[model samples]
Each structure stands twice: as structure tokens, then as C-alpha cells.
Target: MENANDGKYVHINGNDIYYESYLHQQSAKETIILMHGFLSSSFSFRRLIPFLQKEYNVISIDLPPFGKSGKSRRYRYSFENLANTVIQLVESLHLTKITLLGHSMGGQIALNTANIRPDLVQGVILLCSSGYMKKSKPLLILASCLPQFHRFVKRRLERSGLENNLRFVVYNQSIIDKEMEEGYLAPFLKDDIFFALTKLIRDREGDLSKDILNELRVPCLLIWGEQDQVVPLEIGKQLHKDLKKSKLIVLKETGHLIPEERPEEVFHYIKEFITDKG
Candidate 1:
């Protein structure tokens, strides 16, 4: 285990998962865990953390191979493993019951974890979550075998350019500021990420099936962006149907980055839902 201002690292399953803990009032009973999407880190939750920490203990995690976490070539990057890693982290912290708030790929992981161990999770909040996706194509899997192919991954990602990527992430163009751009680009400055991503492509499995999703009894609150290009509102609709205990809210003029696009509104809904459930 290691500690730094960026966050604290806990060794789990042979990899160090970097995370920042904002333990608000010790009297606060609920703990909310924040999980970021693919290629994103704890940085994405910066806007919402302050609001949550004021009322609940908030913990933001940088999933393995992203942010300051260890980028291990041997660690399996499958969603199940990632979810298990998250579970291990919760166990390590001796958390009794927790709520998971995950965006995009992180939401997928959140569902996977809840389904695996319902007793540990009190509820889940999925922000424009990715759902019902097929596995990586055979061609991509074969390409992952090429020696030093990580360079190609790096090149393709860099070619897209940070500004262009941010434009796609949020519907409000004016919100794309220097800080947001720099936050997303910071981890890429590390050369090891490309190789980890290469391994990730080969290890990733398809999203959970409807039958599996149907088994989850944990309550959920899903917030979606009406104009989300990455994961559409329909996907959230499908999730609401599959996860029987879930309710979804869609925000207008919002895109893939729900938290970044509507932090205050999201917080309001979250407070209402959590408080009502309690």
C-alpha cells in the first residue's frame, strides 16, 4: 500500500488500485464509492465529490491501469475481475454497506459487483451506463497479439486529440475548459498505459446479459443524458427495464458526460432517491 496527495493505493489482486477518500462526517452512515469510465479516473468526479462529501462519506477510485494505479500487464482486465477487485477494496476498508456510483464502463462494473454480492451493496447509481454491448471483434483481438502493438493504440488515441474527444463527451461546448482537458490527458502522459490498454482489449468480455441483470435485486437510480452519443438514453431505458428496482431520469441538452454536464441536478436527484429509500 502506498499513499500520496493524488490518492492512496491499496494492493489488491497483485495490482495497486489508486483511490481518494473524502471521509466526511464520521457520523454519516452511508458511504458512496465513485468509479470512473474507460480511460477516465477519479478526476472525472471532481465536480460532484464536494456535494456528496458534505452529506456522505465519498470514496473515488482509479480503477487499475488508470490514473495513478498500477498498470500490470498480467492483471486480467475483464469486467468481472475489475468488479472483484473493487469488492476486494471494499473488504479491505471493512466497509459494511456501500452505494456505488459509476459512469460509463464504470457503471457496468458497478452492476457486475452488485450482482455478484448483493449483501455488500446497498444501492447503485449508474450515470449514462454502458449496457448490452457485444464483445470485441476477432480482428481486434488478433491485432492485440502483435508485438509492441501498444504503440498503435497510443498513436490512435493521440490522433483523436483531447479537444475533439472532450467535444464528444459533453453537449455543452462552453464547458470544455483547459482544466477538464488537462485532467483527461494527465494519465496518458505515462507510457505504460498503452500496453495495459492492449491487454484490456483482449481480456474484456461482453456486457452482462439480461438474464444476469434480471437477477440483481439491489435498488438503482440511473441518470442519463438525452443526447448521449456514447451510450444513448435508450440504453438507460433498457437497463431500467432489466434492473427491476431501478428508476431512470434523462436530462435534456446533455451528452455522455452526465456528471460533468449536470452535477447539481444529478446531486439533487441522488439526494432525493437515497433519502427516500432510507
Candidate 2:
């Protein structure tokens, strides 16, 4: 039995990237790369890993500034830079023709990566993706732009705010236990994490445009929680409408954390999509 918790680190783009690989014996040809969203780590996919690893090799990555991965004050935090680092990681591992699975912000990074190297990516799976949604709040953007405000923003993300965010994103409040909070809050224990996150928000380029989606050559699957308040279901619908080769699936009684809220359904959807041989 593979221990999904064990992880390794690799140097990519001058930073150490942490990732966990579940290499099942039966399925070695196909690979699935899991990318988590903002304020999240690879740990978000804990429930889905075992289910997916049953028939396919799974690799979950910790994007820097958010997980156990190394962070630096000087590194660029734009989505383009993040995509480049992911590409470098893929090349370093000699992984090819992968199914790129991303959640929330990770979805944007996945799309960006696929757009850059269609040759390496075979398909894309987006869970409550963000790039196609409404533009970010101008006030927040302005706040992020001012370097002096970074500390203020950092101070504002108190435990209460974190708890409130958890409640807002996960429809089933019962699952918001101590363990879950601790897991999600672990990365913040590192010094100056808020500064890193602020940099990420401020440096990110504009959202992924329809023009970019139209140019995507690989297959895409957009999965959403019908009750998602963060990104909303309409965004997923719009993405499906815009992406010529994409399909959408919305789960009931769920929120933004579909993978955590309904892992089995997500597993089935992904399995059917990947196994259809389309």
C-alpha cells in the first residue's frame, strides 16, 4: 500500500517544489497531475488520491507560497511563472501526455500549462476554476498593488477569517473539524507566508480569456459544485459554452470543495472521462 502522505522535493525555477506521487503497479502508462488552489496544498486531494491511484498513477504537487514548497521574497508570483515552473517539473520527471487536474486557481494554472505545451498535456480537468469567473475586486487588487499594504493584509487574515472562509466554501459545515483546519493552516505557520500570497495576488496577470480557451487543443472537463459560492456554477457553464472541446459536470449539495465534499463522485467522473478512450 502506498502511503499518500509521504512526499519528496525537487528544485525547480530556483525553488524547491514539494510533490507526492502514488505510483500504482497496474497503471503506469497514464499520469494525472493534481494541482491545488489558493490557500490550499496537495493535501486537499487526500480523499481522491487513493481512489484515483487504484487504476492510474497520481502525482499531487504543492505550488510554492501555498504549501510545504519553498518560498522567496524575490521570486515572481504570476500565473505565467507558476506555469513555467510546472513545465520544468514535468520535464524534470520526464512525464508526458498527462491529464492535468486542477482545482480553483490551480485550474487556471493547468489551462495555462496546457496552452503552453499541448504536446505534454493530454487533457484537462478543472474543479471550480477561477480564471473564467468575474474579475477580482478592484479594491483588493489595489491593496495588493501597494507593497506597504502587504503587511496590513497579512494581519487581517486572522484565525476568524480563516474559519469564516472555510464555512463559506464548504457547504457541509460538519466536516470543518480541527484536523481539517490544522491541515489547511499548516502552511501559514511559515514566516511571511501572507507576504508571499499577497505577491501572488498582485503579480498575477489577467484572467484566462476566451481567446485562450478557444485555442486549447486538448480535451477539458469542467466540474463544479452546484452551490459553489466562491467561483459559482455560472462560470463553469460559461467555460463549457466557450471551450469547444470541453464538457461540464455539476454536483449537487456541494460547494467549492467538491473534491473534499464529494470525492467519490469526482473520482467516477474522472475515471469515466479518462477511460472513455475518446
Candidate 3:
């Protein structure tokens, strides 16, 4: 029953984006839009979505080039454009005032979406966001500029390498089971994946600066794994300090893959966040 969720597709920007929706009997006054991180898909939330759908409607998206979603060589992969596509998806599906839940790179896209369309987002939840990663740019730019270097990087994403990379994201290594490995690696095996990724990295620009963070008038929640190796705990601490009306919760013994590593804890925090009347 783990992979029972059947996903549907929406056409946008000449791409067929994939998403899974969990509907509740209650009216859809509020909903949660889940966005996965870099090199990840909505399958990351498979264990967590059931808990969320119990009380409110929940939808998880597979950002193009990263899930069952279709990819195009011509589609721009910048965060802004991706965020706009999410907005279009929301509008097309008639969702209103959603709480944008984004993990890592998806968090950055959520922040960008909230900034661009504050009217559509009721709140924002960040799971070890990447906007504060200042050291990543130079390395990304270097790799993007060097074709050979990029190829070398791509080589590391082969089957075994992909499994290793998946294990690297979580503090608990036991969760790197066959299902998890396959779920994360399947997207990369597609023919156009590398090209789409190249475009994504080459087009990377801007960050959720203090000005944009300050301008975010909606409620924001910051969740971090105490031992997150990828984005680090310091970034989360700094992000919490910068946001005026945000609550910060750091989970002990957790890693960047909080949803997979500790879904119960994640669900608890998110449920409280959405229900809070303050």
C-alpha cells in the first residue's frame, strides 16, 4: 500500500507536470501544496501525505525534469519560472490560499512563489531551505561553465552513485532501502534529464534575500534537522533570525531528508502550524 497514490498531470509551459492529490470530504477552504527538493520528486512525501490528507486537502507535485513530469529542452528551469508554473497549477486547479510546503530547493521555489503571489499563498513552510546557501553558487557556476566537469559530475549519478547520494541525504542510513533508492533514481535515468538539469543549474539566479524575506507578510515555519549535512543547521538558524514572524523547530538526530527520516515529527509540526489560530 505504500505506493498506492495515483498521480495526475497538468499541462503547463508545453510540459505535462505530474502531481498527486489527496482530497478530503470537508470543503477545500485550505490546502497544502507540497514541493520536493532538488533532484527529488513528490514520492519523497509518500509516507507523510496520508497524515496530512486526514484533516485537509493535500497535493504533492513532481517538478518537471525531476519526476514523472515531462521535460522539454526549451523550457527555462529558473526558480522564478518554476514558481510561476506552480502558481498556474494552483489557479488551474482552483486552489486558494494554500500553505506552500517546500523542502530544500523546493523551499526556495516556495519562497519565490510567496514573494511573487502573496495573494495565493496563505502561509509558507520551509524544510531546510537552500536560499541561504551562499557557498553553492561559485561551485555551481564553475560546473555549469565546464562541460567536462559537468560530465564528470553526471557520471557520479549512475546507479551505485545514485544510491550513495540518496544515503548521503539522511542521517539514518537504514532508510536508504530499495524503494527509496529507486524512487529518487528513476527520474535521473530519463534521456533528457541531464540536459534539463544543465539548464536548471545554468539558469540559477537570485536568492531569498533579507529584503524578500522581510517582505513575506504571511506566516512562515522553519523546520530543520539538527544534523543536516547538505544545507547545514547554521543556515536554518540564520533564516529563523532573519524572518520576523517565523517559528523555528530543529529536530534532533534528523537530517536533510526529514520527511523520509522522521515523517511523524514532520506531520506533527505541520499540523499544528496549519491549525494555529494566531
Candidate 4:
């Protein structure tokens, strides 16, 4: 499934993980691993990958049950397991020092990975992440309780026309082109994929508030969309307050999908951060 413009898969843990490797031709000394949010794939980094590849070996992967990756009904989709799979990918690729960049659910996975294997990661970048949000919508809370119900709802939403239903989740409707909508819909169309997503949501619905932010010692960057309705701007502010070494950049006229909505701005900050660290 290798395309002329995108990268191919490398097998890991009986799953064919889809990833795009950029700057492989160049002699780069650093590696930047990009992880996309829930229901999203490596395609989320389409805008920033080319720019970052100029200096670092940039690699982006589609999380399990998302994108071209295989989904299994038997496996549990917890953040810890996702983090382990990511660490395996890093080790399998022989990446020594990595700058991990994660968006939304991917941000949670990145933090988990960094907490477990701090030595392997050099820095962390989180975009509109979800660890700090304690309260969600009542429907989301109910869906978390009933996994099957959640899958059914997601299916109904997608079949009923995802573009319209997803307007609330995305900041700008124009950012979600036909291809992007199709990409978002692809995973939920599969039964196994739906099950995996349900499991992930259910597993992370508890109160994760306390003091998890204090565990992060790596240099961190928190980017948020001021108009974000999914994970609210307040959550990002709370994250910045809790994480001492982290810096927050709130972009105006942006929503949950910061990387997609404002790719150039997001990339500029990320590039500057990488350069300063290097």
C-alpha cells in the first residue's frame, strides 16, 4: 500500500503499522516521531512532514485500528499498550534519540511512553491533548459505560453523513475536505476498528486529574486552539500550569485539529523548538 507520496509499513507485534518516513535520504542526526490523534492516521502530518524532514528524520504512524493498520477484536486498546507498541516501533527502527510529537489521543500515548521510557525520548510536543480534561459530555460519559452503544452511535453518526456531524468536533469545516472525511470514516466502517475505538474511549474516561503532569521531566510544548470545543482551551491552560517546564501556544481561529487547521504556524513553532534543542 505504498503510495508515491507517502511512506510504507514496517511489521510489529503481528500488526502491519502504516508509517511515512521522510528525510531518510538525508544524513540527519535527530529523529522526530509524529503520532496522530484518535480516528486519524499518519495523513494528519501531511503538511508538516515535508518541512520537518529537511532537518530531522521525520516518521509518522497510524495508531492501531486506525488508518491502514490492522485491528483485532481480542486486543485491549489501552494507553499503556499503545505506548508499548510505539516504543517497539522506535526500537525496531533503531532510532536512538527521539523527539516525540503527538496530537490529541496520540499526545496521551506519547506522555505514557515518555513516562515509561524517558531515556529513549528527548522532547515531547502535545497538540490539543486530552489528559487534563476531567468532564466530557453526558453522551460521551454514557457511551463510555456502554462500549457497544458507543460503537453503534459512531456508526450511526458516520452513516448519517460524517461531515455534518463532525462540524462540532472540527474548528473549520473547510479543513475537512472529502479526502479527510473519507479518511476519518474509514476506520469506523470496520467492526473491529469500531470495537477498538470504543475500548480506548471507555478505558480513558476516568478522572485523570491529580498530578500526572508533575511526572514529565522532558522539555515539553503544548499547542492549543483557542476555539477548541473538543478538549477546551481551559484544559490546555491547566496543563501549562501543572507542567512547569512546558510552554503553551494558543492559536486564534483554531480548533481541536491544530496541526491540520494551522499547519504552517504549528510547524513554525515545532521547527523553532527542534532547532533550539539541537
Candidate 5:
């Protein structure tokens, strides 16, 4: 689960996008673009990638304004922009017909990417995906406009403590080790993350509507943690029903961090999915 390999960054939409590539021995078979959740980075896929990279070319990204990626005030943090950025990053690498595998907020971005450019994306895998959430309310949007808003966000994060956030995401606390906490906390050590997060507050759009999801032509594989508190399993059920071509799998006793909690099972399912779909 450690970042054993040093990742590189690519300039996209006037911002530097950070990504790590794990190539299989013979990568002509399949390719996967892995995206992490809100407040997460490519590190989230550390365990999952080891198994995936054994068979598929895996690329994990740190969505802008998080991790090592550039935190520019001018960079729009909207989901649409982020999706486009992902597509541009893939095209920049000259990779096409790849699958988009995402968790939580990244799941929304993956869906948006497929919806935007299905020619580049052949499949989508969503784990504990975010769905049906509305845009930021007027009050929160107004609050983000304030000069001291970034400070407020910084203080709130400090007050909550990273341990609490980690506990909230996982049903089992045994996995909350020193390395895991440090991996997640590393990106926020700099003060600039606060302002970028504040901008994200006003920049991010709502999750896709059911109508839009229903029209997606790409085949989808949705995995949900039964005990997830962040995004309930019911959302996954609804997502399964919404997408015309999708299969949902529920992992009991698991929580929001599906990759962290069930890498083996996830990898197994992914293997079966690609083989069956192919």
C-alpha cells in the first residue's frame, strides 16, 4: 500500500495533473484509468493496483487541487472540467479504449468522462459511487465567496482530525494504521490546499441526474459497501437500476473505502467483469 514508485505529472488545462502508471507484463490486453475519491489521491489505489497491474495496465491519478497536483485558483474544480481533464490526460498519453475505474467522488467523474467521450472509454467501474447529490446550496456558495472562507475550511479539517475522518469511512478500524493515515494526510500538509478546497466548494457541480445516467451506452460495473455511511448501499441499487447496462455487487461488512477494505475481492470481480464483458 506504499507509493513504491515515483509518479509523474502532466500539464492539463493550465494545471499539472499527477498520475502513477503500473504496466502489466504485456499491456496489450486491457487498460484501466483509476480515479480516487474526494480528498483522496492515487495512493488510495496502492493495494488495488498491485493486483490489477498484474493483468491490466493501471493508471491512478490525483485529481487537481489535491495530492501533488497544482493548486491554482484559476483552475475550475467543476466535475465537467475534471472529467475533461482526465480525458485530455489519457489522450496525452496516447491511450485509447480504456476503462474508467473510480471510487466515491471519482465515480462521478468517471461517469462524466464516459458520458462526454464514450469513444475513448470502453467501460466503467464504480465503487461506493456518489450519486443524486445536488449542487452546493446558496448559503454554502455564499460562504465560499468570503475572504476568510479558506481559513474556516482549514480550521474545520483541523478540528475534525484525520483519524475521525478515517474512522468514519471504514467499518473496521483495524486497517487504520500509521501509514494509511499519513498517506491521506500528506497532501494537506501545505496551507494552499485550504484555498483550493474552498474554490472546489463553489466549483463542483451536482452528481449526474438519473435521466442522464440511463442514457449512457457504456457498460458499467457498480460495487458498493453494505455498511458504507458516506454513500449508502441504496444509492448503488438505484444506480444499478438507472444504468441500462450495469451489474451491482454488494460487499457485506465493508464500508466506504472499498479498495482499502476489499482489494482481493474487488480484483477478482474486476477480472471476471472484463473477461465476461470482453
Candidate 6:
């Protein structure tokens, strides 16, 4: 299961978190923390790490129950708990000035962290982030109301035959190749991981909107894919309006997984943003 790009693991609070650190030898002035989306690992940033590592220290962690990280039966896998875990990781690494970049569910975690600990975070970059959207489709509302039905859907998704279905739901089917499909499906193949995903989905349904976006004192960047189906493009536009100091960049012909589909473009935007701030 170990790849050449595999990072070191650290046992924190009874959980083994898979984390990769770059530029360890150099004296880093600041650190950039990359958070992946739901059902995704630090592997999401595989394409951008080399370019970023050369300049600033780059760190990415696989959250509990995802990737090679430990799965805890004790933890409820809530957003609050995840955010707390991330804060602990930051403290452990002795990172004072950190730029938090999160995609999808990770973005929500970043927003929660900023709201709770503004002093620790310097800036934030959200990619197709959740929150700020209230419209739930009838099917979703029905699934929420019926616990059994929700469980059934979850189980069905984890089946090997449903890999294509899952990929279609997450990304544009036309762009999903064999390798990409395998990468997305590899995580759900494990029973514990699937259970963890269900827990995450339940917790994600709760409200995570923040008023801090309107009063954001720190620099922020919002990147979204124009063809994004999960979070929708309109939500990104709304976030731009909400965050006063935010810059929104929408990549045309891209889908929900912007980092994977448009790595070079996304990397350039982030690199320039961080450099300009300094």
C-alpha cells in the first residue's frame, strides 16, 4: 500500500495520521497546509507539491478514516472534531504563520478553524467549498428523512460495481480515466473507510455557514470549477460576494475536482497569491 510518495505517520490522540512534509531541510518562514476533500487524501495535491515544496514548506495530512490514516471507533468523525485535530497537528508542527487551503469538505473545516482560531491562521484558500447553500433536492431531503434508505444508498455506493456511479457523481465522467477512477475507488474498498464516509456525510448535513466571511480580516482565495456539479458554480459566486477580501477564480471546462483536473492552473493561482501576500 505504500507508494514512493508516501509520507511519515504520526500517532496523535490515539490516531495515526498519514502526513507528508516537504522542504524539511530548508528554513521555512511559513507553512502551507493542504486539506483534501471528502473521500480524498493528501494524494489530491500530488501534482502541485513538487512546485510548492521548492519555495515554502508544504504539509498535507490524511485525515482519520481516509487514505492510510487510522480509523477510530471512538471518534464520531464530525467537522468540529476534525478541525480540532487539524489545529492540534498545526500546534505539534510549531507552525505559527499558516495558510490553510482546503477543498470541498476540507474547505468547510478550514472555515471552521479560522472562525474558532483566527490568531493561528494567516489566510485561507477554498476550492469548491461547502456551506452558504441551503437548497436541498427532494431526493436528498427524502434520504435525510429516511435513515434506512440513506444506509441502503451508502452501501450500494461502496459496492465494486458502483465505482463508475461514484465517479460520475463526483467528477465529469468524460474526464475520469482508469487511474483516476482507481484512485477514487481505492479508499471506499475498505469497510472501515466506507463507514467513516457515512459518518462524514451525516455530519456534513449540519449547518456550517459563517458570518466571518463577510468580516474576514485575513486574505482569502476561492477557486471553483465552472462545471462543478457537487457544490455548484453559483455557490462560488455567492462566496465571492460574501467574503470582502476574497478573490474568486472559476476554471472553465473543469469539474468538482479542480485540483486534480487543473493542477497547473490552480497551483499558479495559489503560488501567486501566497507570494503577493508576502
Best model per TM-score: 5
Clash number for every model?
Answer: 0, 0, 0, 0, 0, 0
Q: Whole-model lDDT for model 4 versus the true structure?
A: 0.77
TM-score quality measure for candidate 3:
0.91
* Candidate 1 per-residue C-alpha lDDT over 63-123 given as tens digits, one digit per residue, 9 for 90 to 100: 9789989899999999999999999999999997899999999999999999888999999
Candidate 5 vs. true structure, TM-score: 0.97
Q: What TM-score does model 1 achieve against the real structure?
A: 0.96
Better of 2 and 4 by lDDT: 2
TM-scores for candidates 1 onward, in order: 0.96, 0.93, 0.91, 0.86, 0.97, 0.84
Residue-by-residue lDDT tens digits, candidate 6, 1-278: 11234478887766778888775456767688888877788877777777667667888888787888887655656767788888988899888879999998788788778877889988899999986644445566456545455456456665636455545444546656677667766776657765555445554445355565676677889999888888898988887888778899989888888777778888899888888888
Per residue, candidate 2 scores C-alpha lDDT tens digits across 1-278 of 34444589998897789999888766567789999998899989988887888878888999888798877767788787898999999899888899999999999999989988899998999999986544457778787778576677567777457789899999888989888888888888755787787777767777779998887878999999999999989989988987888989989889999889999999999988898744
In model 4, what is the error at residue 74, expressed in angstroms? 2.3
Clashing pairs in 3: none
What are the runs in model 4 whose C-alpha is more than 4 Å off?
1-6, 133-156, 201-209
Ranking by TM-score: 5, 1, 2, 3, 4, 6
Q: On a 0 to 100 scale, what is the lDDT of residue 55 in model 5?
A: 80
| lDDT of candidate 4 over 133-161, digit per residue (tens) | 44356777566667366567566666767
Q: Lowest-scoring 10 consecutive residues by lDDT in candidate 3?
A: 144-153
lDDT of each residue in 1-278, candidate 5, tens digit only: 22235489888998999988876656446889999999999888888988887788878899988888999999999999999999999999899899999999999999999999989888999999999999999899999999999999999999999999999999888999999999999999998999999999999899999999999989999999999999999999999999999999999999999899999999999988999889
Relative to the unseen true structure, what is the C-alpha lDDT of residue 201 in candidate 2, on a scale of 0 to 100?
70
lDDT of 5: 0.92
TM-score for candidate 4, residues paired by index: 0.86
Q: Which candidate comes out best when scored by lDDT?
A: 5
Local distance difference test, candidate 3: 0.83
Candidate 2, poorest ten consecutive residues by summed lDDT = 131-140
- Off-target runs (Cα >4 Å) in candidate 2 are 1-5, 133-148
How does each model score on lDDT?
Answer: 0.90, 0.85, 0.83, 0.77, 0.92, 0.75
Residue 249 of candidate 1: its Cα lDDT? 92
